[model samples]
Target: MNAWKMPVAWMSMVALLVGGCNKDEQNVAPTDDNEAITTATLTLVNKAVPTDTVRATIENLNTTADFSKATLNLKANTTYTGTIGLLDKTKTPVVDATEEIREKVNEHLFVYTYSATSGSQNALIVTITDKDTNPAPGPYPVGLSTDMQTGAAGTGTLNVVLRHQPNVKDGTPNPGSSDLDTSFPVVIQ
Candidate 1:
C-alpha cells in the first residue's frame, strides 16, 4: 500500500468508526427536557441568631433601614452561613456578611459552590423580603441599597468551577478551597 494512502485510509476508518458514537453528557440550559440547567445545592449551617434585634445589637446598629439602604434579595426559604458581604462606594467590602444567608430583596450573599459543568452556567436569582412585618425602605438593591458596581441584585451569573467534594480526580487528592470567589455578575433588575 502507498504510505500516504495507507495513513489516509486509517484516518478515514477512525472517523467513520467514531463519528457514530453518541456520548450523552450534561447539557445545561433553560429547557423543558428537565436536564437542561445544571445546578448544585448546598445547605450551610447558620451561626447567627435569627432575631433582628440580636443581629442589630451585635452589629451595634438598629435593624432599621434608617438612612442606610436596606439590604434585599435575601431568600428566607433557604438558610445560608458565613459573612455575606457588601462593597462600599470605593468598591471595598464594607459590611461583612455575618448571617448564614439572609432572606430579603436586594441583598448580596455568598454561594458555597454550584455544580456547573464546564461551558454551562446558571443565572443566580436572589430574593430578599421583609423578614419582619415592617419591611425596610425602597430604592434597595437594583435601585435601593447597592448600585451596579456593588452587585447585581436578585440575579447573577454562577459558572461551574469544578466538581463537588474531595476535589480529586482519578483517585488523586484535589487541591485547595480557593475557588470560593468563583462567581460572575448579573444586571440590576
Candidate 2:
C-alpha cells in the first residue's frame, strides 16, 4: 500500500477501536439515584409481648431535624422485631422512601451503629433481618427489617444510615454514599 494510504488505514483502525470501546459506555446502566428522605420512623415490637411496641420518628430530616419523638424505650434482655419506614415528604403525594429502597434493595443498604451514652458499651445489638435480591455471591443484608436485642439497662444512641450502594453492595456499609444518616436516642430499662 502507498505510504500515505497506510497511515490513513492505521488512523481508521485506531478510530474504530476507540469507537468500539465506547459501546460498553453507551450500554452501561445508570446508577440508582438517592431518595430524598424527610422522615425516618423505627417501630419495634417485643418478641415475648407483641402488644408492647416502641416507636421513634425523626422528621424534617432534610432541613431542620425534629428529633423530639426520636427515642426508643426498651426493656433490657429483650428481643424486638424492628422495621424502618422512610418517607419523602417533599413530594406532592408524599413518597414512601422505604418502598423505593425495597424496590432497589440490591442497590441500597441500611447500616445501624450503636454508641452507649450510659451503661454497657454494647447496649443494643441490631441484626438486619432482610436480604437483597443480589445474585450468587450476594443476597446481602438490607436493614429495612431488623432484630434488635438489648444487652443491659442503658442509655445510648442508634445511628441509622441508609447507603446507596448501586452495584457495589457486598453486605458492607463502606461501598456507597449515604442517602440518610440520623440518630435516635435509646433508653433500655
lDDT of 2 at 43: 99
- The local distance difference test score of each candidate is 0.27, 0.94
Q: What stretches of model 2 exceed 4 Å from their correct place?
A: 1-32
Top candidate, metric lDDT: 2
Residue 21, candidate 2: Cα error in Å is: 25
Cα error, candidate 2, residue 165 (Å): 0.8
Q: Model 1, which residues run further than 4 Å from truth?
A: 1-4, 22-53, 56-175, 178-189
lDDT of 2 by residue, 151-175 (tens): 9899999999999998899988899
Alpha carbon lDDT at 71, candidate 1: 19
Question: What TM-score does candidate 1 reach?
Answer: 0.20
